[model samples]
Target: MRQDHASCNISVGSADLDLDGYGNIMAQSQQIFDCGEPLALDIDEKILLHGTSWKNANSIVCEGFDNRMCQNAFYGAGVYFACAACKSHQYTCNQHKKCCSCKCQRTVIIARVALGDSYVATETRKKERRPPVRSGSSGTYDSIVVKPGLIKGHHKPNQVHQEYVIFDREQAYPAFVVEYTL
Candidate 1:
């Protein structure tokens, strides 16, 4: 198991983002390990980032990712993750005005995502509820991978950042909570 700490600066675009704090999500390791075993003995997992509101981040850390909470299902109705921290940063929210006068900090969850058998999404599938069925097989793809520049849609430009989506909630384990300020 790899242990991550938020002691270094993260470069997003030209800006260097200094983390306010980084801590483990707590109590998710065994669950993540158990969930990946049936998918593959090797466990094809990737450490990805997911950005959301501070309130939602707390909920996720406790209850895990709920695909129904996904507001934008551009790639599919699932929890979305980004390979680049900058891409995930775009979704972070500063919703602290009503609660306190302190500078609102943005939150991003660094997760272990099990992308067992990924299908590259060549086109926009906004209405797709899950990964499409394999062309010549009865089994459906385990996850979706949308590479940069493949999609053209009204809501999104030719996607400039890579994204991964998993329909099963257990497929992702929130590993770390990183807080930062712009």
Candidate 2:
């Protein structure tokens, strides 16, 4: 984690970029991430490694490619290279007798490689299931309510969780964002 108390300079790489032609730009230097390895960063300060995007920006916001999901889900320091293919399913049910409801669910795989050896990363997706319950079912239950009855119901939610070793930089990517360190 980098500190916000000081300002540091970093380099941006414009892939096949020209002084006149604008293209996807990313951080080019490995030094930034290398120095951030030992620092303990808060959630907000992590932005130094992760770039940002704006709806108004014409070019790719995070990586050279325009991925709204990836741009909005920026974390750690690196660029999104590729994503795995996925499919989705929708189901309609009536359990509460209040009304009919439908849900659309899908699973997607995303990958990012940070610059430098100061960090290591692995992406994971977890799927959770809950058994349907009667109308009186209460307590801490996560599920889409269905028509009031004994009908068993299930819902699938896809979540992305990533773990990184901050102090280790054997397989990290170059850092683009920089902040002053002690």
Candidate 3:
């Protein structure tokens, strides 16, 4: 089993993006996903990749285009580059060079779940089911008004559970959020 950490994912199936922009699908290469909503990656998922770029800033934040860094660096020595080229570089999930090479910020990873094996990714986080449970459900089955029958886990616990990253969410994108911080 391959162990990894990751951040938010962008889907490949997103409809609005120009399909002709990125080069032809390289053999078995996957497609790009769409992110209908916005999300953030925990520090563990996207490591800080520092470099210098001359492009204008994407937001009021900074002009750091390729210079921007992932909040969470992969488990390795940062990203590997074929030079200064942006597309030529790749992120390593493992500290070694053999682990899966995560290209593009929204790269998908493989994961095994309680149901079965599948793919999950950062890009699809927004597409998944995020049902909101009422506080009463947490109250549990109280045989007696004074006693609670079952213990219920928080639907989405506070940020503490967001600390470590899971690396594999499902495999539509392999990477999922584990435990993380802003």
Give the whole-model CA lDDT for all candidates, comma-separated: 0.67, 0.22, 0.20
lDDT of 2: 0.22
TM-score of each: 0.71, 0.16, 0.16
The superposed Cα distance between candidate 2 and the true structure at residue 170, in angstroms, equals: 19
lDDT of candidate 1 over 36-118, digit per residue (tens): 44423233566677987778899999999999987656877899987566677777756532223345587889887777667
Sort the predicted structures by lDDT, highest score first: 1, 2, 3
Estimate the Cα RMSD of every predicted model relative to the unseen true structure.
11.5, 19.6, 19.4
lDDT per residue (tens digit) for residues 129-171 in model 2: 2212213322211112111122222122322212222212222
> Model 3, 137-168: lDDT tens per residue?
23111010001112133233221111111222
* Model 1 CA lDDT for position 109: 90
- Candidate 3 ranges beyond 4 A from true positions: 1-13, 16-22, 26-70, 73-89, 93-182
Which prediction has more favorable lDDT, 1 or 3? Answer: 1
What does the lDDT read for residue 100 in candidate 3?
38
- Top model by lDDT, which number? 1
In terms of lDDT, the poorest run of 10 residues in model 3 is 139-148
As a TM-score, model 2 comes out at 0.16
